[model samples]
Target: MESRRTAVILPGRSYGAYVPQLFFPMLAAQRRGAEVRALDWKRLEELDTIKLDKIARWVSTQVAPVLKDCDPASTVVIGKSLGSYAAPLVARYGLPAIWVTPVLISQDVVDGIKDCAAPRLIVGGSADPVWDADQAFQLSDRVVEIPDADHGLMVDDLARSAAGLGKLATGAEHFLDSIGWTTS
Candidate 1:
């Protein structure tokens, strides 16, 4: 956060209208004095509903251009659970990003991120079913384990990892520092 900018995109989950991860991290990041931006992606939550690839690509187009205009080096993108679909797409523009419980069940998503160069912070609760902590470790050099977090990142049962993002962020920021991005 060299210029104190942190932008996040909160796309909806794949199944329902309102999943549990609505406002916690956004508020947390805003509270931390980081600027945040999000996409209201709930309207398109249906699975197998007409060209989902095109829709995902539409999201990428919507998100990338604004962030690109902002100068990606000044921002950090945060994606949680199914909403994490947009993480690597944004990463292509070269901004560090944080992914919390990313539901990367598809191999295509894995292939999409095969050559990302930005720092990625992965956070997940050990008990999370949809996404696991081990999977997070497999995805990035920076990983954080929350004792009981779930796909719903900060429910009463998931707060351990929610609160743990700060501690994990410290390590991630440290890694960024080691590579020359001194963020506080």
Candidate 2:
């Protein structure tokens, strides 16, 4: 079946090929009839390349091409934590990104972007110092802040219902519709 939505998920900064459990929310988007692809954080591996030439090559030759491959009309990038740095890269390549919980990127990186026109959504919580509600609101037209949601967001989930973490999407269709994501 042809996928109506191409949701590219970028995992947070966890050593190795580890994908976080928070990625579960993206499954919600998928269940709503979106095609989901996880961008292995491991693939980027080391952003801090010791070799100047290698660093330049990765961004231009490796990173740039991958981001550009996504078709803009059907794509939405969900970047969580460290992966947030990738949003701008994706935007530069023509895809919009929704930052889940952003971690600050280098000044050089921010300065590199001449323009940021991608459709963005920033979902954060009060407890995430790296991504406060105000910052998120400023960065994206849509921002959802969960009550007492922490950087991990698991604390809030556990408080609500420890056994029901995956249940966040029980009414996901309605939630998505309310957020302007139309289902076919």
Model 2 over residues 53-105: C-alpha lDDT tens digits? Answer: 34333444434545566777666666667555554577566665555556533
Model 2: which ten-residue window has the lowest total lDDT? 105-114
Clash count for each candidate, listed in order shown: 0, 0
Provide the global lDDT of candidate 1 against the true structure: 0.57
What lDDT would each prediction earn against the true structure? 0.57, 0.53
Model 1, C-alpha of 97: deviation from truth (Å): 0.3
Which pairs clash (backbone N, Cα, C closer than 3 Å) in model 2? Answer: none
- Native-vs-model 2 lDDT? 0.53
Model 1 per-residue lDDT tens digits across residues 1-184: 3576566655545533123343444444554566767756534544457474554565565556556665566566666655566665765777666666666664434544444677776666666775655556677878767666555544463355446655555554554454444534
How does residue 160 of candidate 2 score in lDDT?
A: 56
Model 2 CA deviation exceeding 4 Å by range: 1-4, 15-24, 43-63, 104-115, 161-181
| Residue 74 CA displacement from its true place in model 1, Å | 0.7
CA RMSD, predictions in order: 4.6, 5.0
